[model samples]
Target chain A: MRKGFRTVSGLTAALAVTAGVGVTTAFAATTTTSVDFQTHGFPTVAAQAAIPAGQGATIKAGDATVTIPTGTFSDPVEFELLEGPLSSFAANAPSGQTPVFDFAFKVVDQKTGAIVMKFQKPVMFSLTNTDVNANSMYYNIAPTGTYTLNPVKATISGDTLQHAIAGAPVGWVVTSPATSVAQTTSPITGLPFADWLFVGAALMIGGGVLIAVRRKVS
Target chain B: MRFAGRSRKQLLRSLLLVGGGALMIAGALEIGRIPLAYLRVARAEQTTVSKPLVKVQIVAPPPAKVVSYSVNALYPPAAAPGHQPVTGSLMGRLEIPKLGISAPVTQGTALSILAVSVGHLSSSVLPGEVGTTVLAAHDVTYFHHIDELAPGDTLTVRTSQGVFTYKVVSHQVISVGTNVPNTPYPSLVLETCYPLDALQLVNQRYVVRAVLVASHLTPSSAANQ
Candidate 1:
């Protein structure tokens, strides 16, 4: 009787240890890094966030927020401000001419400050005179990398000729990851529920073995 | 007597055996049902076709008289010049006589836009502008015959500002992760997924490089027509 009890106890202890190890491993797999855009302007946020390759990062600028979804980064990256022209509007330019903002920005490593990406292009912003009070401003940002800026709300306010632009933050210009199709494995051939089956089988088998041993003892 | 005189241990053993047998049978049944559950989920996901997030209508070309000028005369004064109104419409027409392709170039490369016409990647330089102007289209449809293009092929873009002509310089196949090449002079880059004959999606991109060779003044009245 004592021998049978000891055997059952040993099996229970083994199963408990296996479950504890599984839980610990799962917890270790996920790592998250958060970035506050309000505290650090885009240049600083881009410089600080340690987004992993194939993963994503989230940015919050005051009331406006955007998510840099997974697969946005082909590799790990940090952003740094390179010497370039700031976005500005011309007051006395030709009436038909759209204002151009040519600038250079770089993506670099957060710790090493090594440059990973650079862009020097003339990005244009158009102003449509909607009545005398409010003008609708429009611009298009096409990403060159594997990153995308989710819909963001920004404000355009400045003097009649030159305005201080806010909410028009530009960073992480890249293509959004394509939606992935979930593939179905042949259930009969590849049982995803095999773990559950194993657990149930283990429970039943352990119970049966205990019973059989008990019978012999009695 | 065997039933009435059964020991407590014997009764406990019988209960354990019965309970274990029942659990094993339930597990087997559950294993059989898993595939069915997975099929239902897969079918649901497959049937759900979401619309493209951004949809911009193709804008009509402006009325302008085509006055062909030499490429040398059309170079912008600056590598990155100030923004000039190129077109009033969101779409421009790209004409490649060599490939017999004349497709509307929309503002964005959304799947919906690519379905019927090519897409002008946003932030890319406009036609006649100095900088790299990147355009993308579906390989199967609009750019199906892109591989037939050769160096020196003439390409024209009719935008709001005017018409611009380009001569193909070279072509190459690049991995998707690689950055698109840029030039200090006026250039055009056409991109599409490669292996034009591939039955499935491929990670390689076929890029065609072209330089501005001519500029044509579009008559204001012609754009209206």
Candidate 2:
């Protein structure tokens, strides 16, 4: 009995060590800055701000928000957010996909008068509209002046579609697949094979008439 | 003789009418059945089997620093760098112990590749990497029973680089056009055609998302080399 008890204790200790290690490993992988910010949507021509390099800002306009993290810029930048039709913000939108919303997030160097296309760190861009979901994808304007599918997936939480990007000062559009109008019925009629059935009936009737006529002659 | 001929004619007309009517009825029923089958299949597409949770012991890898809420951290770049596998080349084997699934994983999702084994999207990152690894197979084949898997079920992939184990986080039946998001951490995505028993192709897919929970490097592997 004493030997059995020792074995049990040893097992317990081993299990405890394993559990502790698992917890520590998971915690380490998840360490991140737990910074949170809130903003409400409002109608504006554009939300532009001269944000300092050391501080971040969350700019919101017309159901869209751009959250620039701290240290995203090395110098004071003039950031502008515009939300409107795709034509207003982008040179061309994707042809076959239905556009959900269009937003252009741009940042400019206050000193050099140059557009800041890339950031030092990633920034969060989200569109909060009831229509957006996993089915919706993000397309950004390319250098060739056409929108292309951003390889990154947009994470969907409830009604919002969000993605993290390191490059900006470009037009982004969220679009869903155009609903396909499938041909549920045949071209001739609502009833499938209607014409074929009529043809079969006609042939059968003709066959019966011929058989009856032959029988009478015989 | 005339009366006999008249009787024969009458019999033939009756037979013709009855047979024609029966044929028309059958055709109508078939026409109606096709649409109903489509409706039934749509419902089946939405259905997912819920199974009892299975507990399995896992030895997780040593902690590696992971960034949270970033594009590079979550999604791998579209143009993956490295010596890409030739089309139809075997990448590795994927296994789900709970479901007793062990299938060869091929490099691409082309018809020829999926015909024999599971296909890994060439654009996605490799297994055990920080980004999402997407694997897909036909529902009629290797992944037929994946719907039976519950959350927390373990999935493992054995490659030359390492043995990566993932835990099931969620299952979703999404439209074919819907994009499965790249998770914030290392993840595995299994996809199959939806409505497992449908005779015709469907516009939906069954997606299983799993997060990497444990992994160990293969000894003297190419990664080590």
Could you give candidate 1's per-residue lDDT for residues B1-225 as a string of tens digits? 766556766787677767667766665665554454445434422332232212222224421111111111223222223242333224467889988776666666655455445677665666665456777876655666777889889898766556778888778887666555333345687878776654345677777878776666455422322
Task: TM-score each candidate.
Answer: 0.34, 0.37
Scored against the native two-chain complex, candidate 2 gets a DockQ of: 0.03
After best superposition, candidate 2 residue B177: deviation in angstroms? 1.3
* Chain A (candidate 2) TM-score to true chain A: 0.56
Over 4 Å off, model 1: A1-218, B1-89, B219-225
Tens digit of lDDT per residue, candidate 1, span A1-218? 12223332232223211112111001111112222221211222211256676665554321122344566445676632211111111222123322222212234445454443211211121211111122322222212111221233113442111121111222222111111111111001112244655665676666567657656745
Estimate how well candidate 1 is docked, as a DockQ score. 0.04
RMSD of 1: 28.5
